[model samples]
Target: MSIYTIIDADTHVTETPDLWTSRAPAHMRDSVPRVITDSRGTHRWVLAGGRNLASAGMTATAGRGTFKNPPKTYEEMHPGAYDAKARLKYMDQMGIWAMVMYPNVGGFGAQQFLKLNDPELMLTCVQIYNDWQTEWASADSRRLIPITSIPFWDVAAAVTEVRRCAAIGHKGILFTGEPQYYGLPLLGDKHWSPLWEAAVELDLPISFHIGSGDMAEGLVKERVATYGKMAAFTELAVDIFLRNGLQLNDLLMSGVLARFPKIKFVSVESGIGWIPFVLEAMDYQFKGNSVAEEHPEFDRLPSEYFARNVYACYWFEQTAPRRLIDKIGVDNILFETDFPHPTSLYGDEVHARIKGGLSDCEESVRRKILWGNAQKLYKVTGPSADDEAKL
Candidate 1:
């Protein structure tokens, strides 16, 4: 039996070398993502047309003990990153009862599929990833919650994928934050209305992971060009964390929440401290700029939509709990480790880190952030009723 009740609200799995090629049809073996060792002996994934899929070694830092250089080959990284059974053991050791898992090869939002010129192949790639991920989570369905990616380029298909994955036990949807960048209609447009309706019907929360938006891609390019790669990553480690703030602002103002009152939106891997700041700005600007006059459909203050439908997660954040949990709202706040990825809360000291960061709050508040809330949000099930009592 487990000794703790911590549920990681967001985490990731490093896609195995043959994740796609093994699952794809014989025809798709060449076009789908596949690992290849180049002449220089460096391992990299390539798409059709031999386009090099650029990756940062930081994507899989588990068991390296330090977030240092890339591991060059799949053998150098930890099995927990790609193996379901291995991750369960790691979760047990870390005292995490459950985790919400996302994918790596597909981009946080599966945006990489957008680059595929063949629209049929692009949608099939999305389906393939989701199907494989579901099988991965089946290793332990109750504790390993799988989030599904959609063929967002086609909202009609996106709606179908959501329902199909939901029927097979996917708890939520991972989507790009800025659809406008993909040449699709924005989330607020009627074009995405069916997708939103499907999400509400399925009772699935929609998560927007950091850097899931094309806006983040644009930001990454501009910053790297200005500061150069090394300095931008080192000097602005917090930059990636902040991109979700823009997503939240757009979401709150988009009227989607108002239109679809039951849908929940999550800002995954984004910290809590900036949320109050963003909400404050949204409410202030809404009034100061007379924004309601421009969009009268917005029936309430922007901040009001947050606790009811918007959620944000935090890890390694000490100040937010001490100063702003109330402003951020306990129900809207979630806890995460972001394990096996860059700056994840892995290793022996992780328990102390979690304790130290959340120490000031009462146990009830802590329990909600750590376990209760996510369980309710993601519909996490059990080790059975009796066993759960001990937790």
Candidate 2:
């Protein structure tokens, strides 16, 4: 293992085709999620009621190397993408001490399941994913940290599931930045306070993955047809970053952070390059509006609250770490390797990128971004006493 105890704040788990079918209730088994080969020879996931969710391309391209053009089949993927034991081995090879795992088929925050006509079946699918995650993390609890997803359609059910998942060992919860996409209330509405409160009470950090909200699928298609696959991928990345910025603006301007001071918000897979600009603009806007008269709940400027509660992660970022680390506060920065994704840093590249990004920084800041921030945010422990003794 490498010298540093790196904790990847964002990673993914490709769900097995039987994930939903095997655990689903007997009455719902016929309609749960399953994989099917299309006439074009591409594997796709079809949810309950026969709705096509996503192709196998994005979910199973981990070990395909530079050949990420058409996306590979599940059989072509490395076992590490789905198997717990194999994943740990991959982590060992990469020197990643731990990772907060998110879902692929679940739409980063399980948002895809909301399309189901039956809310009960949607909730059941979510529970099965959570339970399966718990089992996966059990392979090496200290190394494979699972982040759970809840039923966003019902506020009460979300709260209940949040508590239940935390009790069962989930370190964090993946939440959609735009709940209105599912016809639910916005993040700032009083409707979300109960879920936020439960997250705080359980000490579970709320993670918002890019593209987990109201994603524009048509934009991706247009970009690919006109500009090619690489350009299409770039468009998707840019869209996720822009939307995540809007979500951050909403959280800050909406007084959510002000009301829930103890809770933490993690911007997963969203780079930190734009954080300084956003905070600077927020401060200017807050002052320009004469803060108290407009948003009295905000006791201080938006940047101040962000410095204290919000965290933004970076993987391939080179300039942000050098220029904005001090501005964002070292404690509010985390590191990640998107891992099996098309944009991921594979093998030793993760370490090299992290090292190069933090080259001009101090050891303390490097330590925090590499692993310290995650350890505190997730309450992660170990290289356990036994492991340490052996080391």
Candidate 3:
């Protein structure tokens, strides 16, 4: 077993070129998403009739020094981004121990499938992705945990997929923080009660990765023409990370967390430094607007629900690693590498970053943030990848 103890709360995979084709049923193989090169020498993911859901537009910028031009093909990405064993080896070299995996081809929350407008295809795509992920994680379940994707267009189907993936060992759910962006019912709507209920029962955390139909989508679209693609791209690179704050407010006030107190709502890849400002502001607005009186069932302050049921992850943030841990709450904070992503901690940078950024933190506090919190969140057990892989 690796002597280190760190469980990355959020990381992504660069789905192989044949990710869908290799797993898709014979009848549906041609219809599944796959990569194709355009006349401009850029590789992009497209569906059957070339319905454009762009990933090469920039999502694969892990090792690329410039965000403007990411890898045009899977051949360009760090092998660990797609290869499971390579990922484990990289983690061992970096001393990361374990990591919770997110997605790319499915648009982070499977929002890409909803765009197809074909229910059967959408659901099938989600199932295939989850099944593939489960099989992939079987490489090292204790270290590589997959968060299942769901067809958010159908809540009942989502509930069913949730249960199925849970049974198969997916540790959490990747959900869209703003489903209404796609004209679906809000998370607080009774229409979603089943999903919330199932998550609580199954004890699966609902992780809303940034850009999963969150405000960032709206912001980038509106700003592109005005700011120009170059400027918008640079701004969006960081702006999207903080846009999750929008969900934090809505969730705290919408009574979703209050009603489903046991459902651990995770704001993934969104740094935790903003938690104090936003949660405090949410509490201020809650009292100022008399929301407390209007909502008697919300028996606690907004920040209280955050401390009780919400989690926010952080990386490359010095202030949070230094002092915000107390304000953000120790247990509610989790460490993440966001590995192989443009903003990720790279290679041996992990040890130096932690030791330098969190130098003041006691070892116990650092341990809790690094792996202890994730162990409880993802049900990680025993020795990490190296040891678990041997079994």
Candidate 4:
């Protein structure tokens, strides 16, 4: 009889070594990324930044996982890694009633398959990854909301993929935010329209999660070129805002929101503070006739459309009760624990931290931040009267 109502809006699970290989059709199964020992005597996936895939505690390999390697044991890297029972037990212990789980490896990693430039191959790879992820979430549907990943290279194919994913019971879609992938900028491209339409038609939210897919290449390239550890992560986080702020503004100003009123967009891992600043700057610029003149598609104020459609994750550093509620509105902001990310704060301290920041607000507002807001965003319904009464 658990009474806590916390909903972790974002969390992830590493793909098992057999993820694509096991679920993929015979012809494509062998194409999934394979793990091999590197020059450092560590195991790493051929595709990932080469952080050892086996060292993160997510793998059982003797070498262990690294950012350069996958975990040696899925359980160790992911904590609850592959076991549903362990995951549920941890959720119970931590007072987390539900979570929206994204894939660890197969997510934007599916983009790697796209880079192969074979549509048939990309589609097959995506299907297998989705199948495996769906099975993983079936372990506990009540607690885990699985977000589907789609390959965005071909618009028609992407539309077909979205419908298939929705049919398979996905709550949302995960996409990469990078502009140039293998030497191509996705900005202002018409190829993404159909998939955007499908998401709008299906009334599903599209979540742009951070990682290789959507991360800015400029910073990553700088880090790789310079070999400066401190500068790498710092530049990376800043680059997220610079890149995504434009993308979000583009979606709003391009009449994507107006054309598809049902589509909702969430920018995860990008933090919430940027929302206010971006919206304000856009609105200010719109008044100058520059944004409107350059992009004639926009008719209404850009900020209004954004407020109606966009949502961002709240980080500990960005949690300012009054200013946040005032600038972004309580309903538009949601909280997340970067769970298992080393910096994640997911225990009783969460209650204290949230309480401290939100103490000035009424209990209703606090409860909204704690539970109701996420339900509204995720469209999760509480138990029926009979179900609640049983408790």
By TM-score, the best candidate is 2
Better of 1 and 2 by TM-score: 2
Per-residue accuracy of model 2 over 1-391 as CA lDDT, tens digit each: 3343689998888888788888888999987889888887777788755688877666656566443453546776777888899988787676677988999887887888767778899899889999999999999988889887988888899888888888888999889988888778888899999989998899888988998887766356667789887767777777787788888988888778888989889898999999889999999988998986876777898999998889988999899887878888898999998878878888778878887899888888888899899988988875755654433
| lDDT of prediction 1 | 0.83
Name the runs in model 1 displaced over 4 angstroms. Answer: 55-57, 65-68, 215-228, 235-237, 385-391
lDDT of each: 0.83, 0.83, 0.83, 0.65
To one decimal, what is the Cα RMSD in angstroms of model 3 from the true structure? 2.6
Candidate order by TM-score, decreasing, is 2, 1, 3, 4
Q: How do all models score by TM-score?
A: 0.93, 0.94, 0.92, 0.83
* Ranked candidates, highest lDDT first: 2, 1, 3, 4
Predicted candidate 4 versus true structure: per-residue lDDT over 1-391, tens digit per residue: 3365577777766566566656666776455565655565544555434333233233222223333344544444545655666667777666666777776554433455654456787787777777777787787676777777777666576677778878977788777655455454363466667777788778788887765455435445667678665457566657764566766776666566766666788877666666778888888878876776766666678778877787776656535565667787667666676565533555576667666777788877767766787777677655455544544
Query: Looking at candidate 1, what is the lDDT of residue 195?
Result: 87
Winner on TM-score between 2 and 4 is 2
Runs of candidate 4 with Cα error greater than 4 angstroms are 37-43, 47-72, 107-109, 178-190, 212-227, 290-299, 383-391
Candidate 2 vs 3: which has more TM-score: 2
How many backbone overlaps does candidate 1 show?
A: 0
